[model samples]
Target: MLTITNVTWLDLLCLTGVGVYLVKQVLIKKNPAPYPPGPRGWPLIGNVLDMPRIKPWLTFAEWGQKYGDITHIEVLGRHIIVLNSTKTALKMMDSKSTFYSGRPVIPMVGELVGWKDSLPFLPYGDRFRQQRKNLHRVIGSRAAADVYNEIEEVETRRFLKRVLAKPDQLQEHIRHTAGAIILCISHGYEVKENNDPFIDLADRAVFNLSQATVLGAFMVDILPFMVKVPVWFHGAGFKRTARKWRETLEEMVSAPHKLVKDQMVAGTAPVSFTSTLLEGSHVSAEEDHAVKWSAFSLYAGGADATVSATYSFFLAMTLFPDVQKKAQAEIDAVVGPDRLPTFADRDSLPYTEALVKEVLRWNVVVPTGFAHCVTEDDIHDGYYIPKGTLIMPNIWFMLNDSRTYANPEQFNPERFLAKNGKEPETEPRTMCFGFGRRICPGVSNSHQLTNSLHLANAAIWISIAMSLAAFDISKVVENGVEITPEVEPLPGTISHPKPFKCSISPRSATVLELIEQDANHLVHDNTL
Candidate 1:
């Protein structure tokens, strides 16, 4: 009934969108090859209603069980291919990485929340390559990663002190230490023992990120055009929320950068990833922006994974006392209680090293990984994968796949150690950090176990080793009843173990001296 004169721009836009949607569906061409098998979805909406809202990796694993490894589905005319096995993910993402490395257009987190500038969300192009180059200069290899070993030792020793002082607040201490170490390495700014502004800002922004990146949480992600709607419009509350989060994200990204720049101007900026990069003769705007976000990405890269894995290590120790005792024995045999374990002692403590691997495998920090957008149309494994298809890897299921590990659910460090005639299971590093070009810049793809200490989590390894040597982690006895924590990880893009009580105390009265060993000094000076 409305004529052009009566039609508002919003009305016209909605009409055009509906027309386009219908036409696109009607004009769809036949496929060259059949899609990989998946549960059948209804017409028009396709699998929109079938998408799992919580713990999607478990659902993806079921699809894998029924339909084989590579399962495919369509939502709103878009292709979403899920990989349930390491073999399929590696074959395509590794072999055909040229196009498989592209990132999907995440409207909520990427565009609206302003994380599109981040390395993980950047599409495969010059900008992505430039950012990768920046990260590689600092942590490209294990040797490159080792340059910050001093930082790791200092922060970890501090972590041990905080843990001894307040054992019940273990998670807080782990997060604080991770933030301190990453901040020092990324921006050369040290965190205060009490509340620090940058850390607080980052924590808020990161929690927002965890909420924002959840698949299907925001409708704008599924329908990109929704971003065009006004914030005041009904059902546009997500727009306002995204705007607030974006502001927090921008502050977190820019504040430390401005500090580094100010220090550089005053000639007092200590050596750091940001300081080192901005030391150039002349800086362009694009390069400066890349440096700012990449440095934030460094903290983002390390803090969550480190905190999750380290906390899970404590949880595993609480539940599996025999494993804890065995690891303690290994630490005791290799490095005496008189001195704390150092990175130099890592190789000597193979059992502890295996324990670290088990921590990564068991916790499964990132369950369902970031989706890789296919940049070109192609055929893979007899499947017709078109351009713009999002390939999601089910990392949790892959790590837990019964075919790969002996008892996937059990917290057994011995799985990695070869005994009587059996070799260790497949190295989970290949699956955990991701595959191909989009692999996390923090982790090393090295074939050696010693080099498994990623630039992001090398501190985690040292912290675990030092903690085992310095303290005894066990179940808490309350009201004469020992509390055994459950094996459950919270749902999110980055999974964290549910809070559980545990007892942490010095192994002996003498170990207190080791905890107070001037963490700010020693290790850094020896290397310097």
Candidate 2:
């Protein structure tokens, strides 16, 4: 009996030891793999607590100082690797694009909105391939040139009219003008004058889309099984909002699509993208999903970016009037007072080109360029990134790096110009469009269109340069003390300046007559 009891006691003690070891392994240990260094964050919620609800860029930049070029954090089981430097970003995201080109499989967004098959945000695969090919056909460099003059004319005239009418709402005026150009080109619809239906529809769609990307939109993203549960027990609010977004988005897309379809049936539709896509002779019958996803891609890609660029133009103009003055002088010298600047005189206006490059680098619209996912286990700088990891190119950090740009915060267009005894190894274009095979295909065309808009704006700037030239652009005061102004951003993937007050007036009537004559010619047949 004593021997049997001893054996039983020994077995019990061994069992307890094993249990302790297992518990320690499961709960009290660090992650075995060597991940990139980042700040110590709480369990299950990583650097998310460090991020801001708005202007997360500032926080990310702060973190970059401590963590060096590449920082890694796990947010609720999601491995987010932020590329904080240009060399690392280009080396990994660009050089190894095939291994890191897929987008993070955003569960709620991918399943409901058909992002699983969309071009810009789709995972790297056959669906993405087909959609990208089709989009390239429509908005690629050569094709973009075809629509350049129309976009330039429409945006310029619309912006001028808005500035003339509602000088107080300059930011909104730029937004409306930019949104109108993208809508007109993407679909056959144009937003005219003030509060046009087309503008309202596009604006609503942009807002809804922003809601979908919000960090807390869908809790199901953090817990996958929630998707299997009933909607009432899950992200019920997200589901409802997503449906509303889908409806509003469909309204914007369907209007133009319906027109194209009706015109095609009656044989009168113009040669717009929607009309051409409807013909359906080019795409394979098996690839119907590609067609639908591509339509959404058009709206997503076109609207937010142009608006952000235009907003940057205004901010740059206000902060650095000397740059504006130089650009305007160049425009006047090339085009003369007899006529407004045209695309034909682009090369002659190098200062204007430099200004555009500076604008792109100064305030990047998409600070963290679209996140790309690692499709396969990759080795970078001796670090092993597991397959399915989320890789972010924190591009704003790169653009603002002092190593690349002198006095990075200041708006200096002359940095782009090749001055005497100075050589820039990397061109200004390197940071603007994007990196790698996914570089914005519409860049060349957008560059030209932006230049034309800038020239016309230069003329406008010259016309009114002296009038509002000395006008103070400082924040408004309440009760005699200068109030600390809040920086407002439009709620979307693209961040633009929020509305504020600035004074505007013509320097002289002589300059105003030139603007009036230019507006008349623009309003005529040559405009669109």
Candidate 3:
């Protein structure tokens, strides 16, 4: 019925094409589910300006209160899905792991700093699976409990000696202890001093990586093409920084690996993760590459996280003197003051064990836990989640969920205790380590003990029990005034208590004598 004589045939064809495109768009919109609700943002920027650079987890948690458990936001058109509840995270990240375990590509952290090789940032694929297998074979929960038990005990004793000698440098001593343990297990290398060069290099590299991966920290991360800009160009300092970071990262990954290889050739290699993997008869060059990077991954992030948790334990003790007193009382009743607490005393010291779990919950390390990306488009609870969407489990929110724990902000270990005053029925490891395939490989190795109270938690549990039995972490007294330590933690991916002053003193002369005896025995045994 339309008259086409007034218009050219080409123009009519164009009009018809436009009509078809509009109809298709409408059909497509009607077919797909809607994205999860989030704060509306302007076009193009898409919540980029609204994203908090520091302690973003808090913001996400607050948003979860307004929105549902699953909240979606976009940063410069990149889809971000935050899981605020344990149930949702478990369902999505754990039950549907295959479709949700991919790691988002961070140009600055992955491409520039060379962290793409690390297992934590590696994409979900065959290589990632192989690396995980190798890591689990060495440091998995069962393996860590079996092989590293005695080593953890010796290292804990050495750590006590360092703390006894320099109580003022408690955090430093904790760092040294964690570094020593990981170095020994990963490369069969001993960290003889707190200032070991390898430790220094690893620390610097991790710091750089953490800074680079902060959301919205680097422009190039969002605008990947900016990486092509010359280093000399104005505002291209990020390029220069990345180059320097690459050097440190390369050394962190390769230096210790080369050392192990050299020792293997010289017939002096110790039985370590690297040596075991390298000595295997069927190991290929590809497998060697996987092992090398996998081992370094253990050494790179392990020490810092351990140190952070330890510091949090100290901070908790300082703030809650009553909690400290209760834990110490339990340790005394179970282990007695004759010797330091050991793995053998774990079962008898239920309250002390509860304290360790509480510390992990109080100030979660890696709050918005390592982001997992989706491998394909999926519908979750009627909400459409497109492929490559970044999925972050709000660990802090889950740990502090008021529905799960009453008075969530208070530092209380009693929440974990069973109604009958027995061991905790439910451990917090699920929330602490993470969910599904992307869960921390070191979860079982990092914490959580078998019924035997093995080495997995020996470093932290023993240190905590022994320290409580030996020292009183009280408010610092300057002159006659008591300076209350602040309980607030610093905002970061791995949060630690802000610098706080507290007095660490032996409980009594008898306790000091016991500490001295233990130190003498460690030195006599050449364990330190």
Q: What's each prediction's TM-score?
A: 0.94, 0.80, 0.89
Residues 204-295, candidate 3, lDDT per residue (tens digit)?
A: 88778667777778877766766787887656789899999999999988899999999998999888888888885877789889999988
Q: Please list all clashing residue pairs in model 3, or write none if there are none.
A: none
**Model 1: how far residue 384 lies from native, Å:** 0.6
Q: Write the per-residue lDDT of candidate 1 for residues 448-484, one digit (tens) a residue.
A: 4355457655877898999888888888898999888
Flag clash pairs in model 2: 467-507
Q: What are the per-residue Cα lDDT tens digits for candidate 2 across 1-528?
A: 444324442343344445544665677644345788877765434454554556656666777899888887765446778777888877886778788777776766666543444566666677767766766665554343344454555466546555756677876776676565555554555566678876777677766655566544456565454456554642345666666766666676557656666777898765655555667576455454465556556656655666666656666666566776777777667766555555566567777767766766776766766667788877688676877887776677788889888888887778877789886424445655556555543343223443323222232222222222222233345678754434466654556666545444443454456445444344322111
Off by over 4 Å in 1: 1-21, 446-453, 523-528
Inter-residue clash pairs, candidate 1: none
Better of 2 and 3 by lDDT: 3
Identify the runs in model 2 with alpha carbons over 4 angstroms from their true place: 1-33, 43-52, 112-117, 142-147, 215-218, 228-231, 280-289, 424-429, 440-492, 506-511, 517-528
In model 1, how large is the Cα lDDT of residue 516? Answer: 73
- Which candidate leads the pack in TM-score? 1
RMSD of 2: 8.7
